[model samples]
Target: MSRHFETAPGLCEARDTATNAYVFNQTMLRIKDPERTLDFYTRVLGMTLVKKLPFPKMEFTLYFLAAIPDSQLEQWSKDDGERLAQTFGRPAMLELTYNWGDKDKAEVNYHNGNSEPKGFGHIGFAVPDLAAACARFDSLGVTYVKRPEDGKMNNIAFIQDPDGYWIEIFSPENLEQGLSEHLGSDQDQR
Candidate 1:
């Protein structure tokens, strides 16, 4: 036997007024080699390296990447401080934290959160064309955890990053089709 859980109710109306201004920002990941990780993200994934901040005293650096449109990139501020402020203001960015001297070490200093004691699952990206994106990834020799046609959820695919973090990929059309079919099946069950 199995159990179905109901969706959690929304927050109180009073709280909505205070929380409406909140915006979800970036997710940070610890990287071993900044060069390799940056190459993978910027080259393979087509993300723009918006800002890079080095802290010599702290012995760490922060690299911010975002999937901003090329048109928007063209209009970005020429001033360094303003550009950084713009990067900070944007949502849905990826922050890679690179500790000094970690790249020189033979062993990875941080866990990818998918092995042994698992915690953070994965981050996802929505592409315009799933098939073409997967094909491009194949050409680039990107490691796949699950191909689009591999399992029950054939509409989605998962690929690994340089640090072994899983990145889920799917297109809007496929996601909508899958969701509609799933919802229809659930309606039949009810």
Candidate 2:
């Protein structure tokens, strides 16, 4: 199907010709241990569980989570969910798909797209305070791929989840200021 977007001034909206609308609802990640993954996302990252859909026939469960509270999504239908997904500056919803047998087998592993071909790069999160977030992650024993102090991109940092997927943390103000100061007038030239 063909996809189109309507752009007016500063706003942009994605639309589908046939369907009612097209939204980037969620990014699905196949997780081995749901308990550990849920803890990492909820406790460490402070995401709320918005919806949980279980498929007994398919032998899998889908957990939808976002930074917003569950109360906000209580009345949201499928269309509302799609509209919510289109919102920018709001935390993107995460869909964790857990296969029923993975936990039982203990040997099933999901490729985090970091090795070999490296298809998926990383997911990013914008925080109000980057330093505090990094510090908290440190206290939680989260694995760091790159710290803000380690590289030229001092405003951004990357952390790895238990599944090895990289999560980038940054502040919008920090990124703007850092890039401007780092680049100076040479930004336009580059």
Top candidate when judged by lDDT against the true structure: 1
- Badly placed stretches (over 4 Å) of model 1 are 1-13, 181-190
RMSD of 2: 6.5
What digit string (tens of lDDT, one per residue) describes model 1 on residues 18-98?
766676879999999999999999899999988899999999999999997788788778889999988887889899999
State the lDDT of candidate 2 residue by residue for 66-155, as single tens digits.
876567755444664664443322446788999997877867877878889778878888899999999999899999999999888889
lDDT of 1 at 143: 97
Q: After superposition, how far is residue 56 of candidate 2 from its true place, in Å?
A: 0.9
Looking at candidate 2, what is the lDDT of residue 127?
Answer: 91
- Determine which window of 10 residues in candidate 1 has minimal summed lDDT: 1-10
